[model samples]
Target chain A: MKTDSEIIITLSDVWKSFGTQTVLKGINLSVIDGKTTIIVGPSGQGKSLILKHILGLIKPDRGQVLFEGKDINAIQKKELNEIRTKIGVLFQNAALFDSMTVFDNVALPLREKTVASESEVREVVDEKLSLMDLRGSNDKYPAQLSGGMKKRVGLARALVLNPRIVFFDEPTTGLDVALSNEIYRFFFKTQEKLKYTAVIVSHDVPKIFKLADYVALISDGVIQDCLSPEDFQMSSNPIIKNFVEATMGTIYSSEAMEV
Target chain B: MLNFVEKLGAYVLYYVNEAGRMGIFLFFSLLNIIKPPYNKIASVLKQIYVIGSLSVFVIIFTGAFTGMVLGLQGYNTLTKFGAEGLLGSAVALSLIRELGPVLSALMVTGRAGSAICAEIGIMRISEQIDALECMAIDPYKFIMAPKFIAGIISMPLLTALFDVIGIFGGYAVGVGLLGGNAGAFFSSMQSDVEFIDVYMGFVKSVCFGLLIVWLCAAKGYYVHLERKGGFGAEGVSNVTTSAVVLTSVSILVMDYFITSMLI
Candidate 1:
């Protein structure tokens, strides 16, 4: 329904290899502003690698990663850090700082990057924690939190700065179906409210499809195709068809047995 | 012969590359320290407490024992020449010149250095470091700079404490136990030990502190690039072991060079 689609991040012919193994041969993708673009793939297909490239955590061997038309890899450290401030990342394991309390973890970026006062930091931290329904859990460390709670806290920290672009790497990876749905609902409400450009790499498959404006299938070190969710399911490309059918079949068959 | 030469060449290249990488890491760590937005006083104080205060008991225990052994041995040896009154000078000169700094450094390398490596290695493996990067905060400034400051400040103070405690231990063994002339012990030590000897100890402690932190932190920070067991809990343990061993060896080696230069 939103018509003003503008591209925010562009990965052009990116290639990467680690030691003897080639992880991404050549990856080209565009992330549109204010939209949820979900990347789904089999394991080791370079889905997370792409997100890292966009975040400047990894550099490509062959091509450029353009953020708002500036090559992130080509920029200086200060500029790159400046660019990173506009971004948020939710790692698969939640990756909260173990030494810090939940409040500190959520308030870190604001304190480090902004000129916010202590009172301002407290107010913002409280607001973000409340947003995640973690109002009373600010003092708990990551080791004390459950998986679902950690995930929610990770989201809270990610959105604390109100970053323009949020990257979720397997956000619902270890959660049960009910928890996954609950997380998705949070995703929906936050995205609707904050309007952040979301680039999520997930394995939740069909359930993840509901949150995506566009779905990209990564396979064999390249994106096979990127299409709308409805068209992705109906994609005639054999790779996309096989992936969609296999995942859907697995989920549906498992559900039927339970029923 | 060709295979042996090939292996030799590989070993040489690997060590050269690693040394260069370590040098670069130290350079950047130093550079980050001098850059703006310095670490908070509280963070540095916490590291000082962890690296300095926590190691006090061990340093005292070891220093006392080392000096007592020196006193017992020196008293017996000097008695041969009827020079047993020089016990205090012998103990003070040896401790202030060499043993105080070197032994204290080795202790810290075992206690604080290994723990620092393990902690940073765990953080590296867990992606907490990566998360810091994603948040646009410099890990060097946030995590490492405080430690470097603490190490530099703590080492000299710890070395001083070790020397003082060791001198007392020697006095107790020589004058109290052996019934040596207490006035002669104090006078000989005062006359023989110069400021330069104390200066040498201070210099060595500072260098040893920097070396311990630099090597241990680098080893842990780059745990992902470790050659063996670089992906899990195994990786952390392997790197921590290497860090402690490497730092210990380097401390002894550095002590020799510094002594040769300054002495």
Candidate 2:
């Protein structure tokens, strides 16, 4: 439904290489506002690298990453940081501060980027934590939490700022099937409610397609195609077909392909 | 011979590049400190507790033992020349001018500096630093500047504590156990130990504090870039060990330069 919406982020002919290994070669993609864009690719195929580029964590070897019609890479540091406050990122492994408690971890961005009073911070943190089903775990350190709990906390932290956009880098990499399903459910509910633009790099294959408005298949360091989940499942392109079959073939029940 | 020369050149270039990188890192870290929206006071206070208060027990223990040895040795040496009354002056001057700062720095390096390195190195490897950057939180301002401030604040105080405890330690041994005159001990120390001696120790402690924190924090911050820093837990461990060793060596080397200039 949002396919007709305006584009919020555009990556134009981005080229990035590390030493002798070229990771992203002349890749281009666009993210529509208030839509979930899921990026799927084989590991080490620079799937996560694309997220880093959009976030300005790493510079492309060449080309531009535009956010709301402005070139993020060419902007001033203060402006870039200001742009960053409007976007949230959930990295793989959660990346929670080991020294801070779960509550402080979630409250970090609000505390750092906003002038919210402690009571306001507590109110927001509590609401987010409750949504993440992390109530009563405020005093727990990241080391004390389970893999599923850490991911939920990470998601809570990412959402605390009510960012206009969010990027998830393999949010459920280590969770069990039930836990992964729970996280995906949380993702779906949050994305549905918040209506924020989302760019997720995931390995969950067919299951991930359920939450995607657009699915971009990346192979050989370039996006093969950006299609709706339904069209992606039915595409005849060999690369996309093989990728789909290779990932979905393992769990290929007739019903599982309908996402 | 040709291969040896090539390897030697490579080593020299690597060290030079590393030194340059560290200088730039320090420059940027200082810039972050002076920039607006300064680091929170609570963060600095927490660092003060970790770096200063936590190291108190070891500093006191080491300072006491060092002064006791100085008292026992100084008394023995001066008595040979019928100058036993000068033992208090010798112990007090040696402690206030040199041992207090250098030894205390080494102790804190072992206790707090290594932990700081390991903590930051772990955060680096774990992507916490990158996460902070993603959240628009300046990693240097949030994580590093506070530690630097804490180090500068704590080092002089710790060195002063070391000197005071050392002086009393010397008294406990010289007057109580060695049967030396208690009044002669205090009087000689008061007469011979001038303000310059105290000033020298303060300067050395402050300098050593900065060196310890700067080198340790930089080493950990750049662990990913180190040629042998590897990745994962092994990388953190290797970088932390190197940071402690390097900081200790740098403290000693900087001590000599400061002393040579002041003395």
Q: Which number leads on lDDT? A: 1
lDDT of each residue in B73-168, candidate 1, tens digit only: 999899999999899999999999999999999999999999899989989988899899999999989888888989999999999989989998
- Best candidate (score: TM-score): 1
Q: Give the alpha-carbon lDDT of every model.
A: 0.90, 0.89
Candidate 2 displacement at residue A111 in angstroms: 1.5
Candidate 2 lDDT over A72-105, as tens digits, reads 9999989999989889888899999999999999
What candidate 2 keeps of the native contacts, as a fraction, is 0.79
Query: Which residue runs does candidate 2 get wrong by more than 4 Å?
Result: A1-5, A250-259, B1-13
How do the residues B57-112 of candidate 2 rate in per-residue lDDT, one tens digit apiece? 99999999999999898888888998888878999899988899999999999988
